[model samples]
Target: MGAGQSKAESDEHFSEEVVNNLSDNLASPDTPPERQSSLDAHIRSRIQVELARLREEEEHVREEIERALEKENLDRERDMAGDETDSGVGQVKSTTALLGDVDELRKQVERFHSKKDDDDFVAARLKSEAVVQCYKNNPSTTLDCWKQVDEFKASVAHLEERYVESLR
Candidate 1:
């Protein structure tokens, strides 16, 4: 194996030396016709081979860069997704708290309406009872019953004002 390696090394050196000599000769002003075409073909083939190799190297480098960029983009997306998930959890908590507050407010409103209805019923019943009592006490004149009716109206107005003030 060692002998073969040495032979290969010597062959490479010899080929390099031959190519250098040919290049130097061809570059001179006194170019020979017999060797001109052969040397020109050889030089053209060498340049084409080098250009192809360089192109392959460029493609390989481009592929490596693309892979690296793709991985970086994926990592960035994952980080953004994680942040969104964290914010989303916070939003859900806040929404839940708001909903609880709304429910409590709805219950309070329902209770207030219930109380208002009860007050109305009581006031109406009292007015009716007062009217009947006034009629029984003053059966002689309908004019005397105006006082009780006016008093009942004033009481109902006062109750309405109180209810409005309590809401405020």
Candidate 2:
């Protein structure tokens, strides 16, 4: 206890001396050249020492962070391993059921796709989008979209004919 207290007191005194030395150097610019050089060298050495201490502290902190990260990773791996043996079994069963549902959905989707005429549907959708965009761009001159509206109507009619034929 006594040694620690004395060390703290000495550190405080050392810092005070450094501060006083800096102030004295700044306050007395006309100080003797030799004294000024000595002060400069002292301040530089103190700065280098402080920098080295900071670097050592930084390395220690980096090591601690790496250790913590590794611990967390190990914990995560353990949890993942535990999960695979427990809830994961139930999940696998549910996933298998879901896969069967997906296969049924795929068959239905294929049947629906067979009824669709892609070319006619794409033409109709494109024409519809063009008409809507024309109306949006020319809000005040809605008549300017007449050509687009006609094209959209024609494409939709063609698409409808294809759909009815597919139904037959």
lDDT of 2 by residue, 57-116 (tens): 999999999999999977876676678768656333244566999998999789778645
- TM-score of every model versus the real structure: 0.36, 0.39
lDDT of 1 by residue, 1-168 (tens): 899999999999999999999999778878677678899999999999999999999999999999999999778766766777787853222345669999999999998878767866578668868988999998898678997798788877877887788789
Alpha-carbon runs more than 4 Å astray in model 2: 1-31, 87-125, 133-168
For every candidate in turn, the CA RMSD to the true structure comes to 22.7, 13.5
Which residue runs does candidate 1 get wrong by more than 4 Å?
Answer: 1-28, 89-168
lDDT of candidate 1 at residue 116, scale 0 to 100: 62
lDDT (Cα, 0-100) at 161 in candidate 2: 80
Q: What C-alpha lDDT values do all the predictions have? A: 0.83, 0.85
